[model samples]
Target chain A: MGEFELIRQYFMPLARLHGSSSVIVGPGDDCAVQRVPPGSDLVFSIDTLVEGVHFPVGYRPDYLGWRTLAVAASDLAAMGAEPSCFTLALTLPEADELWLRDFSLGLGNAAESFGLTLAGGDTTRGPLTLSVQVHGVVEQGGAIRRSGARAGDLVVVSGSLGDAGAALDYLPAQEDLDADDSAAADKQFVLERYHHPQPRLDLGKALRQFATAAIDVSDGLLADLNHILEASNVGASIELARIPVSPALVRLKGSAATDYALHSGDDYELCATISEASWVGAPAWLKQQLTVVGEIEPVSGLRLDGSAVVSGSEATGFDHFRRKA
Target chain B: MGEFELIRQYFMPLARLHGSSSVIVGPGDDCAVQRVPPGSDLVFSIDTLVEGVHFPVGYRPDYLGWRTLAVAASDLAAMGAEPSCFTLALTLPEADELWLRDFSLGLGNAAESFGLTLAGGDTTRGPLTLSVQVHGVVEQGGAIRRSGARAGDLVVVSGSLGDAGAALDYLPAQEDLDADDSAAADKQFVLERYHHPQPRLDLGKALRQFATAAIDVSDGLLADLNHILEASNVGASIELARIPVSPALVRLKGSAATDYALHSGDDYELCATISEASWVGAPAWLKQQLTVVGEIEPVSGLRLDGSAVVSGSEATGFDHFRRKA
Candidate 1:
């Protein structure tokens, strides 16, 4: 099929969506249209996913498509902006028809799931890399930034942390697993978490109402939340015991892949702060959907139940520069 | 260096630009804010450059940085939109401080050169890939889209064509070229064409006031303009003698690689159409800046000096998917 038809068929149907009203024009032109609310601000974020580094070396096209968009969307989720349009820049070694078909299906599904439209993007020659720049809107000066956390705020999380990291560890890349160990048994949870972690848009919008500070846990809770703490000049105390460790997580706890839980990263869940006073009035859904794992304090350094964590020591999160080729 | 600090140090300064009145928020959030002019629309486009695909394997980081953003800005120019804000999604194998320092310098240089601000972006682990999403504003629905050309429109181009593709043929992908080859000596032109293309934003704005259709010479003069003819359902006739060929390009004609210049692609200049009646009255700068390349006709297909130009046949321009990995 022709390039124009291919995009129209697979991506256009994904436009005219929830984040579309402000987008006066969506795709099919030199550019897409998005109107800033009369007095509101615009928030922008971009994310890139390389095939082998960001995902399993042999991951399927479908999951690659979903994970790519999901990761970028989560950035918009971190800021309290209404998810709008996104541009996708895809580079691939070659255009395998089957891979394109499956990838488009997964991309279409995720786009439908998030109510986001494909605005525009470029398809180019290169190692497979997916880059998405997400656009969202915040009412005039209403965005919750990393700098807004106060000393006495409660650090909250939307959903359990480290599920994606667990999923990654649980996925086959765990070479340390006994050669004879049965991977089939652990594949389901890991696959779901790895492939389709939702971009909490609804929860993100909710956070604008309750969150004073927020960030998406892309580089692990400790590292990403540390961003907020640093931006706000505050420290955080996590009840290592209370940081929601799911039953799925318990399976990995014995694995010291606890590093996976502690910092293997890529959860894409929101980590936020609300004043201890405001936490009292947080919506019932906020409590049900998000876990209160820590509290913001006036001190400087991360701690687990009052003990120093990573104090003048090595970090336990993704290191873009340190990874071995 | 800390990831957050590195970003704040190099990136925050780029966003310090005071953009158009439509920019409610410039950068530093999840997205950017742009005011759609009363009756105007938001024009969007994205472009990606991969380490080895768009450039040589060991191409300079600084030039890549500048070129990446400049090429994407050309899309806005193609639509007759004023340059606005842009978001970057930079994927690198490693974040070497020196590499990033030069990269940011080039990025900052381009932002300043183009009067755009770097708003927000994602940095992730991957084979090197750079994605830029540029947003521009067209006067309330005045964008000159590819589908707007019609029979009897005067086809035009903003600058001399083929220099880029010709330059590409002679560009040294490895070490410096030998002075013995005349074509190789032309590497300077090709490198400039490839690494430092002008986005034509001013010419684009002028065309919006005088043209009926527009497109960037990304694919090739013949092929890209064909996209306009095909989309507008009109044919075009060109005086082959009138097709603008730069000094460097004239030397390369008649060689097999001439086809590459005619069809090799990656020149991000503007090719547009003006109605025959509006053609003579076109704004002064547009008349000064662009050349009449051809004229549109009631029939379908393209002609050069009354002979049909071979299009949609063999290789016309760069096709990411069709290329060998």
Candidate 2:
């Protein structure tokens, strides 16, 4: 199929699934025209995933599609914005019909799950890469920011922390896990967590009412949480025992499980800070997703169990061009 | 330098150059948040350029950066939307500080020229690729779209056509042309057109007042005009003698000058359908940019000089995957 044919056959169908009321002109135009609800702010973000560096070459197309869209959507969640639509800029080495079909199916599933629609996009021939830009709407003055955290705010996180990180550490051992029947389920669980991270959109929306600051845990809990601290000009003291680690992660890497929770990245869960009063007043369901792990302080340094956090490969999370070489 | 340092030094300055009032939160965040002016619609588009496939493998980084932003911005112009802000998703093989500095300078220059700012973006290590997503705003019902073309409307284009296309065709001859001093200035003009074709922003905005339909001539005049025809379910009769050809383009292609005007892509000029009454009322400065070339017809085929348009290798504009084997 040609680029136009591919877009028509695969992408165009995805656009038709949800007829968004806000979109004046959707796909098949030079630009997708959408209306931002009056009294609302437009929230937008772009993320690119490249072959080899971001994901292994020849990775499953469906998973790759889901991951690219999900990761970009996570940024909207961090801002407490309701997703409106997204545009994709895809680069592929060639046009493969079967691969394109599966990828679009996965992309459609993501759009459906997130309550957003495919607006418009560009497709080009090149090395395998995907860039997704998401647009969302937030009520005026309701959007969350990393710079809103106060010195005495309580830092919290949603769900488990290290499963995705642990999955990355043990991905190479998947082939051998099948031989050991006992490890199969855990291996599948961890791998799925890594491949399909659930962005905390609902939790973030709830946080808009109570949280002082917010960020998505993309580059490990420590690294992402530190972003909130640095932006807000404060410090944090994380309780060593409070970081949530899933059973699958602990089973996969036993004694070093907490290390992954602290430093390993790709956890799309959210990290936020709230006042003590808001934490106490938060509804039960909302509280269940959040676990208090630390408290913000006046000084500017990260600490664990009252000691400065200074030792570990995972301490700083992954940096693209500056990763240890 | 680390990704953070690189952004602080290069990207952050671009964001600070012109403080955009619509931007609620700009850069240094999970997502950039901005407000769409009340009673306006948000218009957005994304475009990706890959090394080798989109341009030469070792193309000038500064020109590459400018071209990437300018081409994406052209989509906004086609929609008759005012440029607001843009995000960059850049993938690179390595962190070459010098290359990054020049590229960011070009990107910053484009942002300043278009009156937009760097909102937010992602950077990673991989094969060289740049994906830019531009945001614009237009009155709720003011966006010019391809589907709005009507029969009897005059097909008009802004500025000269095919300069960029001719430049691409004659680029290899540039080195040889330098030996012939007479061709030097034209060579430079054509090369600049190829590398940094201006987006007709003012023309597009003006088109909202009089154009029934509009599209940027990214893919040759004939091919892009066909898009408006197909979308609006109309045909066109293009006057061969009326097509505007620049002196440099005519000088370079000689006998094939008309062919390039008819079929060359990437001119980045505005091709729009305007009612005759609106054309007559248009201001002289705006009228100077527009040249009448054809008329929309009730039939369902494109023609030139009373004959069907066929028998040309460059008949269709470029398609990503279908251009060539």
TM-score of chain B, candidate 2?
0.95
TM-score of each prediction: 0.90, 0.96
TM-score of chain B of each: 0.90, 0.95
Index of the highest-DockQ prediction: 2
The weakest ten consecutive residues by lDDT in model 2 chain B span B309-318
- Model 1 chain A: ten consecutive residues of lowest lDDT: A311-320
DockQ of 2: 0.70
lDDT of 2 at A258: 91
Instruction: Note the chain A TM-score of all models in turn.
Output: 0.89, 0.95
Model 1 per-residue lDDT tens digits across residues A227-272: 7877788888988767765566666455554456567456678889
The deviation in Å at residue A158 for candidate 2 is: 0.5
